[model samples]
Target chain A: MSLSIFLITLAFIILLQAAIPFLLKRSIAFGVTIPEQHMKERALSSYKRFYSATILITGTLALTVYLLWAKNRTLSEDQVVFAGLAIQFGVLFLSMIMYLYFHVKTTKLKRTHKWGAGLKQVRIADLASHAKDEMLPSYMFALPALITAGLLVYTASQYSQLPAMIPTHWDIAGQPDAFSRKTPFSTISLLLILLVIQGMMFGINVMTKRSGIKLTSAKKKASQIQQLAFRKYSSWFLFLTTVLITILFGFIQLVIIQGGMGNAAFMAAMPLGFLLIMLIVTAIYAFRVGQGGSRIKVTVEDEEAMETAFVDDDQYWKAGIFYVNKNDPSIFVEKRFGVGWSINFGNPIGYIFLLVSILLIVLISFFS
Target chain B: MLIQIETSSDIPIYTQLSNQLIELIARGQLKGGDVLPSVRSLASDLGVNMHTVNKSYHELESKGIIRIVPKSGAVINPSIRDGISDEHRLRIVEELKPIIAEAIVLGMTAKEIQHLASSILSDMKEE
Candidate 1:
């Protein structure tokens, strides 16, 4: 396969990634979850219009760029790949901007009507008594780490068998494109990557756990249960991902030494497999439980206690997304209407953490 | 030691915290010398402002229900009647006056009012 083939696949992957978030956002229309039931239709219509317009503009821009690039046969494969990637990414960036814009509008509309405005913050009595239940799922990452270690030993056992130059990069059609020296680092780089990914996922899991839940007074118990469920579900998701990555990378390592780079058909399918798994899981949970998993109907259906349940407290959210509450000391809190956790921008520690995280990411990028 | 507070209640958050702490203390759920959580930690747990938690702690301290040892955590004070000054007695009566008046206005019979307070006591015991 040529560079063009890889580029095409990458563009498609990016497009799908963008669409998944949009799909979750679309669930608000069903009133099965989010911003309470009454105001959902309004949000739905406004968001639908916003999304449609953004998609139209983004598609046109991408298609124009692709056609323009198609007509120019002088461009090298690298240029074609670069052009395709840029077009897809540009579309994503534009759509995100539009998404935030509409989010701000919806937030303002929610505020105007005073939706969920009367719900009080629920406080836990004897905070220390029940705090032990919020245990970190660190063991989840450990499982993958242990698997990687086992694989590392297996790879090292074949140290004498690996070729002088091992295949490092593959083409879309499963052909080796770039080669690297068969040193421990080169042969084991895939494992190292897996380890780094595991660490990042674990860190995120811990951070999300620390991010406190947001719930109203009447629904405090139900909300707490939901938050715990969501956390449990997320950790399991992380663990599953680690196991999958371990198997994939472990297989890749074995294939490189055992069957040769040309035999690595799995390499081409790995990305597609990962994306499919992630999309399927996300779709199932997001639809079933909704954002923060707060609207989950399973145990949260206590009728008498749900009078104050969860209100769409989107008013305090700056731009209808970033929660800004000076009174809240938590650095992180579950997002009001999104699937993931959001930082409490109102807290100084949150800004510091965000800055540090960005710096760490930059350093990692440079070192890697 | 469960202390639940409602933020939107007309009652202040600190009052809610203090009232629940008092209830726990009275019910023996919080025994003498039982250490309460630090202001910062409690605030973080409940997602409330530090001052709000501090206020609650201070309120408990002022009532002689808890002792805030310097550099140490707040501890429940032994509920000994060291001697009730007339002013303290008056204050207690003043606190109870509103409840009695509200119950009377609601047309609750004296026996029913007693039953209501007893039900609350019984419920607190269950927790």
Candidate 2:
């Protein structure tokens, strides 16, 4: 792959990734699970249709902007990649503003609808004893650890062949932008990142498996099944990301070793493409399934529950967004208006975690 | 065991929690030595205040339905199976007094009230 090809591919991959959560929001009816009777109504409703249309329109505009930007044949390959990335981010920002406005409006609209009213009383359900055991093979958790160890060993064994000075960093166009002596500290940053990410993923999986799941009820069995499926999907997401990280790191190691057999660009493309394709696929899956298996079909349990008993928790939901119920000791809860989870700002520990996490991210970005 | 807390009930949250937990023990859904979820966990699960759950746990401990060990979470007491005392009998009667009065006010026959009590007991027994 040439530099131009890589840049365009990377741009599209990122735009797609950024667009996914919004796309998935359309499939979901205000971030709640799809009840069988409400399935068509939810899908066909103006909220979903408008959101879907907006996503399509935003995506088309983003691509057109990229194509038009790419027309600047006078620009260097590096400039092209940089410009493409900037455009994606700009387009994504606009799309996000549109989503936030419409998403809040849609959520409020849902409150007046029967399906929304009936799906209230959102409570967490305990994980069935078998859920964790059944979701994925236990061995899958060890894959990242094993791969990391293997890569470390392999890199160490090739140290003799590695040049005294190695390229520590590369620009977006597969060209070396920074160099350092062939030391573990210089070349092993990616490995460290991978390990940290793996640890985080492990923590997440354990938490999900042990913690109670949020359910829109009257369908206990189906909801439990859906929770389990979501857990399974989460595992796959972790596995794929781990694989991508390993490839990119391994690619770096190869560049440091044999200089990629004189096909640097081509060698980089394989792993980069693999990573991008995985991201695109994951985004598509998220779009179709929504968060926490919202769109997965199962037999709707006929048993009726107090579905109409909507908890008037708006006060607890601080600023109508961040959940700040000091009484709720849970560290995490399903996000009220989006796919995935949010940390409870109520629990003292949870509050601390949120603050520390934000601080760490900011500090890292600034220093890096 | 499945335990439910009615969020919309007029009764106080702690009182409702204690009552439901006691009922669970009565029906054998929660057995002797069966550990309940930690106070924090249950409060989080029910989306209620932790102090409310703490109060409920204390109430159960006072009644001898569940024990709150220093480090361990609440556990149902084996002594829950022990027969009631004269005090307990008096307490039960005292608790039922208002309802009995209401039944009388509503013009329900004594036989009908007796049947209602019997039906509830039978349902609990089946569980």
Candidate 3:
């Protein structure tokens, strides 16, 4: 439960995930149109390679840390090292399962349209129609990572005060401390939450991909559900953590006032201040994430008429002539209709900037 | 001669290729009876689907612009001496009438429209 180990694991996962998009981009650059049948195969194969490399490196590092911490230490007969290993293995298995599920779902969607049919004449209008469908599964694929990260954070915190070796006692009722009292419950809760989140994300992915435009109406309902979930989780976390910190602070103040102005108060206050700052930062980030979720661009074009329209739900920007006027065929009828293309906040450049910023932050964290 | 195909353009690849060939012929850049690349060879060279190049050759052949010989290659056809038939001319004029009306609607006077047409024709002749 060392802080360094947790940070190292986080760094490994983020770096590996970041490289996935870059690899896909490289394949596209090489003029290899990953055919529908092979898209998942190629992606999974690449992911396996990345996962193996990461596991090998991180596993060695973790083993070294364990050896250093638990040197010459022997656990009692009931003490088990297998619980942590089981959780890690379970998370990995679930990630693979989620990946396969999405791959199959996206493959099925592509097959329904037939090979090359959608891309053959590929008008801008076709892209507009297909954008929503294509993007739906991406969020699903991201679900496993989100679930795993959440589970890991919860597990880390729950097991933070545990010694390097597990205790021999099996009875929670006879345990000496609160940490030992709820150990089994905490572990079981973590696993169940992971499973539920992963399953829900997969279900949402499949349902949305199948429902397509029907999901747009459902999306509004889903958003309300999501907001509720956010509020529920954040408030619960804040309330519990706030209570725990306040109690800890009160204990420190009692000791400090008795001992007469000492370092204990500063130590207690430091973490409280740090927690408040983290909550504020997380709130800002969550707001930005919500803002980014709602908008998507749609490109429309007519190849025959040589016209193009870039539209979203709220606004439409069209360029080129839709038709030559019958009364004035000699004069081309053109309309450059859009509120303001430049003013649109949700452009491709913004996505690129966000991606780069995330990468920069992850890299900086690694070095730090 | 190499004819590039722009797949992402609004115009179909076949039409683009055919137009380029026609323009080359009209400018005497490709002379009558000159040999052209085989469809498969041209398609491979241009990194296009073979069917695309085949369609372009077919369109050119149908228009009497190029003659395709089996296993030999395509060759430019001799220019036609006679002008379009009276029926065809009338059909073209019928299509132009609406365009003329459109020009009038766009604030072009009849004389101005006529002048513009003549100038375009003269420019084409120079090409």
Candidate 4:
């Protein structure tokens, strides 16, 4: 059952990867910014087909190997899982290689054509676009935080009831594989970690709400609607993830406090169920609202001058993926290729936040 | 209001920003007490330097079209509250002097210039 679940997860990931060419902003192809009219070029469509075929074939081969290896009775479950993970990572690495190859080809084509040259490169911004209004209310995040805090307080009150050796780690079969002496801090440590992670999600929510909305210049009103809808859906998705994670951790905490006495299959299934829900939500949101809301339909007349295209600031995007602009004060911008935001590499604050997050994770792991 | 800046235009980006904003206000799309986005947000959205947005905001403030409160950002001032001052009148003539001179040099009659101005005025007033 676990293997089947893993296979399904892997298939979903591969499907998403193969759909990238169709999922990206209409102006962007293979990480290269192109004129809107050039999107229908024969060469571009052929490249997309080749990319998808390569990814699908590679993914199928890797899954087959994983299934064959797992069915062998000699290996333990942990070893089988590790091998599956390694195969998954290998597939991901190859997909990156495929993407880079096509990225280079598209960039070359764009250069040879001089797509946006000698045009009035313009950017449109709606002065009335309110960041705070585009997001879910801040109070919605408080429920999970409140639950975590309540759990922490309850665990403290029942500290004496916990077993001397508290279960700190559970394996794939949901058996307690690791334990730590039940000090007051160790008893409530998982709750603390949960709170910290919830806080991080809240921080990201704040960042998304604060970031400026970037609109396509051709149809200002239509683009504004799309941008706002994208923000709204993404914010809701983030909130759902946070709440789901909080509930899972809360469940785990309750089982731990009860001396890790739970049904083995159910315990193992909890996380798998969470993963499935998250994947389904992500697929729905991505398809409904493509990267930068490119999939959303909003009609405006094509009355803007043909020469006036969106500002061709492609020079700042490294390989059309990494955005490094020294002048942009924004720390978070919508990703050029993906569903959500990417950090501005030129901003020192991005590095600072990243380092802090890593340190926090390490510290939490150490304490627990 | 959609504010667009043409990077290849002869006019400076800051001037274009301010002019578009003024046009929006004239069209009644932005009214008194309307707040503009902050300089950092606007600049990043437009992919321009923050200083450019700041310059444009200051230009609006100088013309008494908006008030830049330190923490709250720029807000449009009530246009009916203040009559045109002599300083503003003089500055307008100074700015348009070269344009009118070019029109005359190009052999435009006084009546034709008046006709052009009235047509533009009517266009702006249209809903």
Worst 10 residues of 2 chain A by lDDT: A124-133
By TM-score, the better pick of 1 and 4 is 4
Q: Of the native A-B interface contacts, what share survives in model 4?
A: 0.76
lDDT digits (tens) for residues A1-368 of candidate 1 = 33444344545544443443343433242122244445346556656555665676566666656766666667665766677767667766766676676665655655586655565445563455335445456766677788788888988998897789888767765668878767777777777777777766666666665555444445556655666666666666666777777777777777787845435466777765766676567556555555556546555464656445443434456655567888777676765445656778788766675576566555543433
Candidate number with greatest lDDT: 4
DockQ score of the complex predicted as candidate 1: 0.43
Please give, for residues A215-237, the per-residue lDDT of candidate 4 as tens digits: 77655667677788888998899
Native RMSD of candidate 1 (Å):
6.5
Query: RMSD, model 3, all Cα superposed?
Result: 23.4
In model 3, state the lDDT of residue B20: 76
Give the docking tier of candidate 1: acceptable
Is model 2 an incorrect, acceptable, medium or high docking prediction? acceptable
User: Residues B1-127, candidate 4, lDDT per residue (tens digit)?
Assistant: 7888888789999999999999998888988998998898898788778999999999999988899998898999987756788998899999999999999999999999999999989988995
Off by over 4 Å in 1: A1-87, A110-136, A151-166, A180-190, A255-262, A303-316, A324-331, A345-368, B1-12, B24-45, B50-127
Sorting all predicted structures by TM-score, with the top scorer first, yields: 4, 2, 1, 3
Cα displacement (angstroms), candidate 1, residue B127, comes to 8.4
Model 3 regions lying over 4 Å from their true place = A1-368, B1-13, B41-52, B80-112, B115-127
lDDT of 3 by residue, A197-312 (tens): 34433433333222111111112333223322332333333333333444443433233223333354454345445455555544443333221122122232222321121111
lDDT of 1 by residue, B29-125 (tens): 7889888877866775677788998998988887778999998789998877678768768889999999899989989899998998899889878
What are the runs in model 4 whose C-alpha is more than 4 Å off?
Answer: A131-133, A299-307, B70-72, B80-83, B103-112
Prediction 4: B-chain TM-score: 0.93
Interface RMSD of 3: 17.4
CA lDDT of each candidate? 0.65, 0.61, 0.41, 0.83
